[model samples]
Target chain A: MAQGMEIRNLSAWYGSQQVLKEINLPVSPNQVTAIIGPSGCGKSTFVRTLNRLHEIIPGARVSGQVFLGEVDLYAPGVDPVSIRRRIGMVFQKPNPFPTMSIFENAAAGLRLNGVDKRRLAEQVEKSLKLAALWDEVSNRLGQSGAALSGGQQQRLCLARALAVSPEILLMDEPASALDPAATLKIEDLIRELKKEYTIIVVTHNMQQAARVADQTAFFLNGELVEYGPSSEIFTRPKDRRTEDYITGRFG
Target chain B: MLHSYPFRKLLNRAVTVLMLLAVVLALIPLFSILWHTFERGWPAISPTFFTHLPKPVGETGGGIANALAGTGLLILLASSIGVPFGLLVGIYLAEFNPGGLGTVVRFLNDVLTGIPSIVTGMFVYSLLVLTMGGFSALAGGVALGLIMIPTVTRSTEEMLKMVPTSLREASLALGATKTQTILRVVLPAAIPGILTGIMLAVARVAGETAPLLFTAFGNRFWSLRLDQPIAALPLQIFTYAISPYRDWQTQAWGAALVLVTLVLVLNIVARLVFHRDGR
Candidate 1:
C-alpha cells in the first residue's frame, strides 16, 4: 500500500531571505494534489522542500517536520538520500543525461540503488510502459536520450524517475513546456500514475489543475492561501484570493 | 529595386580589397616556410633518414633517428607528469571550491602561462639541471611539463564549466552522491574538450627548442636512458641551422618539416576524435 505525506510548519530560507513561510498540508495516499499559483509564489520551492532537494543549494536551509507514513524525514541523523529514494522528482524541464542512451537513462536510478543487474532491462521496460513511452521508444532504445523530441524527453525523464519504484512522485510544472497534445498526454499519464503512487504536481494552468487534481492548494507570497477538494476550491472558493486566481482575475 | 549609393559601393569595394590584401599578406609567411622547407629538405628524405644514425660532422649521408626517438620519449614523459596533475587541479577549481583559493590558483596559472618559454627553461635549468649536476632528458621533460600545466589546467576548467548545471541536479535528484555525479556525468560530458586541450598543449611544446637547449644539452649518440642527455628534433634543427656546413643546414630544413607535420597531424587527429562521437 502507498503511504501519505504530512508536512507540518515547513519553512525554507535562502541565506537571510525566507522563501516558504510556515506551511502545513496533508497529502493523502494514491491521489494527485496540485499546487497552483502565479509566478514567484513559492510553488516551486514548496515542491523542492518535500524530498529535501532544496537544502542542496548553497546557502539554502529548511526547518520542518515532513512525515512519510509514520517516519519523520527530517528526524535527527535521517539521510536525505534515503528520503529521496522513496520520493522521486521530475523537474520542470526535461533533463536526461546526454551522454547516456535512452535505456541507460531510465535505469540510472535503479543502478544507483544497486538493483539486481539481471532485472534492469525488465524494470526499464516496465517503467517506460507505465510512462506511456514504451511504444514510441522501444525500437530506438540505443539512441541517446537527448536525441528524442521535447515531449518524448519529458516522458523519458518520468520513466527514469519511476524505474526506482518510488512510493511518491513530485512533478514541478511537468507539462508547461509541452505543446497542447503533449500536455494532454502528460495529464492522462498523471491520472494513471495516481492510482499507484501519491502524486503532487505544481502547475500554472488552472484548467489543468481542475482537470487532473483531486485536491488543490493555492499559494501566494510564500503563504498557503487555501487547500481543499478540487471541485469546491475551483467552483466555490472560500478565499477571495483563490477565487480571483481561479476566475482569471489578476493571477 | 533600391538604388545603390555610388560612394557606399566604392567604400564597400575598397574595404573588401583591403581585407583581401591583409589576408594574403598574413598567408605569405606560411606559404614561404612550407615552400622553403620542401625545396631544401626533399633531397634529405629517404628510408635511411628514419633508420640510420647521424653521420660524422664531415659526412653528409646521416639521419636523425635518435632525435625522433628522443622527441617521442620526451613528450611521453611530459604528458605523464603534467596531464594528471593539471586535470586534478582543474577539477578542484571547477567543482570543489570556486572561491578565494580557486581565484588565487587561477591567477598563478595565468602568470605561469605568460612567462616566456626561455625563462621557464632557465628556471628548470637552475632548479633540476643544476641540482641533478648535469643536463638530462629528465630535465627537458620537467621543463616541458612545467609549460604544459597552465595550458591543460585552463582548458580543463573551461571545458568542465561548459557542462550545464541541470545535469548535476538530475543526477543528485536520483539519489547519487556528489562524487558519483561528477565522475559519471560531468566528466564524460567534458572529456572531448579536455582531449582537444591536451593535444593543443602537446603541439605547442613539441616544437619548443629553447627549453631543451639547456636541459637536454643535445646528445649525438643513441641514448634511451632518461637520466642521460637526449637529442630532440627541435634541438637538432637548431644546432644544424647554426652550423656553417651546408649539409647540416639542409638537414635542419628536413627536421623542421617533420616537426610541422607532426603538429599538424596532432591538431587534425584531435578534431577528428572530438567530432566522431562528442555530439
Candidate 2:
C-alpha cells in the first residue's frame, strides 16, 4: 500500500533526438494522477519511462530515476520485465490480442511469469471483475478478445493489465477513443480502480482529468509546467502556460 | 459542329481498336506456345507410355516412369532438407536478426536469389559431385535444396515481414520471449504466406535439369538408394532431347509434359493457398 512513484530529473530520447527533458514529479499510490499536455509534450513519454516501455523501441532510450515506493526501477539489476509486471499499462487504443480468447487475454501476463493454471484462472476472473468486465464476459471466456466491442475491448485491456496484480497502472488516453457513454464508464472505472492500484492517466481531455484525478500535472515541451491538486490546478494554476493549456487556448 | 463530331467519334473508334489489337498481340503468342506444347506432348501420353520405360529409336513405345519417380523422390528429399532451413532462416531475418547483421543477411539473401539456377547447379555439382567422387540422389537433393534455400528464404522472410508489426509488439509486450512470440504468434499468422513461398520454390526447382544432370547423372533404371545414381524427369528430358533415338525424343516430350504438370499443380496449389489466406 506504500504506493507513490517518484520520478526525479527524468529524460528520454528516441534514437539520438531527445524527446523528454529533465523532469521531477511524484504519483501517490492508490490514487489517480492525470498527466495533461499538448501534442508531443512528452506526456506519453513520461508515462512510458516509469516501467521502461521505451526500451522496446529500438534506438530509443531513457536517462532518469523512477522509483515506485522504495525500489528504483531504473537501478542496475532491475529486470524490465519484472518492473512492468509490477507497473502495468493500458495503451491509448484498445488492443486485445487478436488470437487470444477473453480468458487467455486476461491470463497472458500471469502465464508469462510462469503462473500455474488454477491460480491464473482465478486471477483472470478476479481482474475481469475488477475491470467491471466479468459480468458481461463471465460466461463467454472462450470468445476471441478481438470480437469485443471497442469499450469492452478497452475494459479487456484493463483486465489484462490488472491480472498481474500490479501496484501501478499507466493508462494513456484510455477513454479518448471511447464514445461519451463508454468514456463515462471508463472514468467511473478509473475512480473504482484508484481504490486498489495507483493509476496514472494521460489525457487530452481536461474534463476527464478533472473528473477522475486527485492530482494533475501539466506538461509542455518535455517540461513539467505545473503539478498540484486537481482543484487548485484547475481553479488557480501558478503558471500562465498551465492556464493556457487548461483553458484550451493552445497546446 | 455536329458533322465534326463524327470525325471525333471515328478517332475514338480507331484508338479503341488499336488498344484491343495491342492486348491481342500480348496474349496471342503466350496461348500459341501453350497450345503447341500441349499438342506435341499429348501424343506421348498413353497407358503403356506411362507404365513402361523409354524405348530405343524406331521401336514401339515406353514410359518416363523411372524419371517421374526419381524426380518425385529427389524433390521430396530436397524439400525435406530445405523447407525447415528456409522457415528458420526466414524467422531469423524477420523476427530476430538485428543491427547491421540483418541488413547484411537481407542483402546476401537477395544476391543469392538473383544468382542463376544453372550456376547454383554448377556450384552444387562441384561441391557434391567432384569432391565426393560420384553423382548420387543425395547429391542431387542437396544441390536442389541449395538452389531452393535462397529463393525460399527471401520469399519466406518477405512473407513473415509482411505480418503487421503490431502483432509482434503485442506478443512481446505480453512478456513472451522472442522465440515464443515467433512460434506462437508471428509464424502462425504468416503460415499461409510461408506455405505459398515453399510451394513456389518447389515448383521452380521441379523442372531444373542443369543441377540433376551433374548430381544424379540420369539413371535409366529406378534406384532407391540416396548414394546411388538416380533418374529424374528433367534429366530424362535433357538426355532424350539430345539423343538420336526418335523413340527417346517422343519420351522426352512425354517427360516434359509430366514435368509441366507437376509444376502446374504446385503453382495451382500455391495460388489456392494465397487465395484462401489473402484476407
Candidate 3:
C-alpha cells in the first residue's frame, strides 16, 4: 500500500548556503504531488530531502522533520538506507547501468537485497510491465540497457525504480531529457502509478504538472509561494507570485 | 590578413602531409628493430633451442629452456603478490578516500613509478637476499613486484575514476551499500581498463634485466626451487651477448626475440580477452 508523507519546517543547505527555507507541506497517499518552480528554486532539493538523497553530497545539510507515515525519517535510529529502499528515485537523465543488461537493470535493486532467481524473474517482468516497456523489450532482455533509445532508456530506468516496489517514488525532472512522445508516455505512466504509489515529482514544466499531478505546489527562491489542487493552482493561483509564474509573466 | 577558402584548404592539406610524414618517421625505429631481430635470430630458433638447456661455452646445439621456465615462474610469483595488493590500494584511493591519505598515497605512487628499477633491485637485494643469505628467485620476484605496484595502482585508480558518478549514484539509490556498489557495479565496469593496466605492468617487468642481476643472480642450469638462483631470458641474453663465444652470441639474439614475442603475445591476448568481456 502507498504511504503519505508530512514535511514540517524542512530547511536544507549546502555549506551554509540555504537552498530550501522553512517549507511545510503534506503529501497525500495514492496521489501525485507536483513541485513546480523556476530554476534554482529548491524544487529538486526538496524531493531529494524526502528520500535522504540530499545529504549524500559533501557539506550538504538538512534540518527538517519528514514523517513517512508516522515514522520520523530523520530520527536517530532510522537508517537512510532503509528510508531510500522505501522511497525510490528517478533522476533527470536516463542513467541505466551500461554494464548491465535490460533484465539485470530492472532486477538490480532486488538482486542487491539477495532475492533468489525464480522470484527475481517474476518481479522483473512485473516491473517492466508496470513501466510500460515489457512489450517493446520482452524479447531482448539480455541486451544492454544502454542499447535502447532515449525514450526506452528512460522507461528502463523507470522499470528499475519500480522493481523495488517502493511505497513512494520521487522523480526529479524525469521527462525533461525525453522527446514529446516520450514525455507524454511518462506522464501517462505517472498517472497510472498514482493508484499504487505516493509520487512527488519536481518539474520545471507547468503543463506537465497540470496533466499528471493531483495537487501542485509552486516554489520561488526556496519558499513555497502557494499550493492547491492542480486546477485551482493553474487557473486561480491564490498568491500573486504563483499567478505570475503560471500566467507566463515570469518563471 | 585572412586567406581565401582554397588557400586555407591547401594549408590544411600541407599540415596533414607533415603529420603523416612524422608518423612514418616515428614507426621507422620500431620496424627496424623487428627486421633486425628476425634477420639475426631466425636461424638459431630450432626445436632443440627451446627443449635443451644451455650447452658449455663453444658448444653449438643448445636452447634456453631453463631461462624461459625461470622467467615464467618469476612473473607468476610477482603477479601473485603485486596484482592483489595494487588492486586494493587502487580501490581505496579511488572510492573510499580521495583526500587526506589518498592524496599522499597517490603522490608517493607517482614517485615510486619514476624511481629507477635498479634501485628497487638493490633494495630487495639488501632486504631479502642479505637476510636469506643468498640470491633467490623469491628475491627477484619481490623486486619486480615492487616495480609493478605503482603502475597497477595508478592505472586501476584512473580506470575507476573513469566510471561515471551517475552509475555509482544509481547503484546507491537502489539501497546497495558502498561496498556492494563498488564490487558489483564500479569494479565490473572498470575491468577492461584495469586489465590493460595489468598487462602493461607485466610487459614492462618481463624485459627487466637490471633488477634481476643482484636478486636472481643468473643460474647456468635448470633450477625450479624458489630459494635457488634462477635463469631468466634477459639475464641469459645479457650474459651470452657479451661472451667471446660466437655461438653464444647467436643464441643471445634468439633469446631476445623470444622475450619480445612473449611480451607482445601477452598484450594481444589481454586485449582480445577483455575486449570481448567488456561489452
Candidate 4:
C-alpha cells in the first residue's frame, strides 16, 4: 500500500518573493491529486515542496512541515536524500540524461543507489513496462535516451523514477511540452500509476486535471482557493475565484 | 531603406569575394608553415633519425631518440599531475562553490594563464631547481603541468557549466547524492568538451620550449629517471636551431616535424576515442 502525504502550513519563497502561502492539504494514498492554477500562482512550488525539491534551488526556502505518513520531511536530522528516494518527481520538461542510453536512463536510480547488477535488468524492464514505454523502446535499449521522441523521453524519465519504487510520484506539468497524442498517453500513464503510487500532478490544463485526478486543489496568488473532489471542483467550485478561473474568465 | 536588386547583388558578390580573400589570407601562413616544414624536414627523416641518439657537434648521422623519449615522459608526468588537479578545481568552481573561494580560485587561474611561459619556467626553477639543487625532468614536468592547469580548468568549468541544470535536478531527484549526480550524469555529459579542453592544453604545453630551458636543461643521451636532467623535443630543437652546425640544424627541423606530428596525432586519437565513447 502506498503512503499518504500531509502538508501543514506550507509556505515557500524564492529569496524574499513568497511563491506559496500557508497552504495545508491532504493527499490520499493510491489516488491522483491534481493542482491547477495560473502561471506564477505557486502550483508548481506547492508540489515541489511536497518532495523537498523546491529547496534545491538556491535561496529557495520552504517553511512548514510535509509528513510522509508519520515522518515530517523537514524535521531536523532527516536526510533530504532519503526523503527524495521515497518520493519521486518528474519535471515539466522531458529531461532524460542525454549522455545515457535508454537502458541506462531507466536504470539510473537503481544503478546510482548501488542496486545489485543481477536484478537490474528485471527492474529496468518492469519500470519501463509500468511507464508504458517497454513496448516502444524494448528493442533499442542501447540507443541514447535523447534519440527518443519528446513523449517517449518523458516516459523514460518516468521509468527512471519508477525504477526506485517511490511510494509517491509528483509530476509538474509532465505533459505540457508534449503534443495532444502524447499528452493523452501521459494522462493514461498517470491514471494507471495512481493505482500503485500516491500522485500529485500540477497542470495548467484543467481538463487534464478533470480526466486524471480523483481530488483537485485550486491555487491562486499563492493561496489555496478550493480543494474537493475533481467533479465538484470542476463543475461547481465554491470559491468565486475558482469558478472565475475555471470558467476561463482569467488565468 | 531597400536597395536596388542589381546593386544588392553586386554588393553581395563584392563582399563574398572580400571574405574569400580574407579566408585565403588566413590559410596562407598555416599552409606555408606546413609546406616549408615538410620540404626542409623530409630529408633529415631516416631510420637513424629516430633510433640513434644525437651525435657530437662535429659528427653526422644521429637521431633525437632521447629527446623524443624525454618529451613523451615529460608529457606523461605533466598530464598525470595537471589533468586530475585541473578537473577537480573545475568541478569545484562549477558545482560546489557558493561564491567566495571559487571566485578567488577562478581569478587566480586566469592570472596563471596570462603569465609568460618563461616566467612559469623561472617560477618552477626557483621553487624546484633551487630547492632540489639541479634541473630535472621532474621540474620540467611540473612547469608544463602548471601551464596546463589554467587551460584545463577553464575549459572544464565551461564544459561542465554547459550541462543543463535540469540534468542535475533529475539526478538529485532520484536520490543520488551530489557526488553521485556529478559522477554519473554531469561529468559524463560534459566529458566530450572536457576532453577537447585537455587536448588543447596538452598541445599548447607540448610546444613549450621556455619552461623546459632551465628545468629539463637538454640532455644528448637517454635518461628516464625523474630526478635527472632530461631532453625534450622543444629544448633540443631550440639548442640545435641556434647552433652553427648544419647537420644539427637539419635534425632540429626533423624534430620540429616530429613534434607537430605527435600533437596532431594526439588530437586525432583523442577525437576518435571521445567520439566513440560520447555518443
The candidate scoring highest on TM-score is 4
* TM-score, candidate 1, first chain: 0.98
Candidate 1 C-alpha lDDT tens digits along B1-279: 655799779988999999999999999999998888889888878888877788888987889899999999899988987799889988998888678889999999999999999998999999989899899999999899999999999999999998998888878888888888889899998999899999999999999899999998788889978889998999999999999999989888888888988998999988987787667
The digit string of per-residue lDDT tens for model 4 on A1-251 reads 89999999999999999988899999999999999999999998898888788898878998999999999999999998999999889999999999889999999999877888879999999999999999999999999999999999999999999999999999999999999999999999999998899999999999999999999999999999899999999998999999999999999
Cα misplacement distance, residue A63 of candidate 4 (Å) = 0.7
Candidate 2: Cα lDDT at A172? 90
Clashing pairs in 1: none
Worst ten in a row by lDDT for model 2 chain B: B166-175
Q: Give one digit per residue, the lDDT tens place, for model 2 in A13-65.
A: 99888888898998888889999999999999888888787777788888879
Kindly report, for each predicted structure in the order presented, the TM-score of its chain A compared with the true chain A.
0.98, 0.97, 0.99, 0.99
What is the DockQ score, from 0 to 1, of model 2? 0.35
Question: Each candidate's interface RMSD, rounded to one decimal?
Answer: 1.1, 2.3, 1.1, 1.0
Q: What is the C-alpha lDDT of each candidate?
A: 0.91, 0.85, 0.92, 0.92
Instruction: Tell me the TM-score of each prediction against the true structure.
Output: 0.94, 0.89, 0.95, 0.96
Candidate 4 iRMSD in angstroms: 1.0
Model 4, residue B105: displacement in angstroms? 1.8
Worst 10 residues of 4 chain B by lDDT: B270-279
- How close to the true structure is residue B190 of candidate 4, measured as C-alpha lDDT? 90
In model 2, pairs of residues that clash are A3-A29, B52-B63
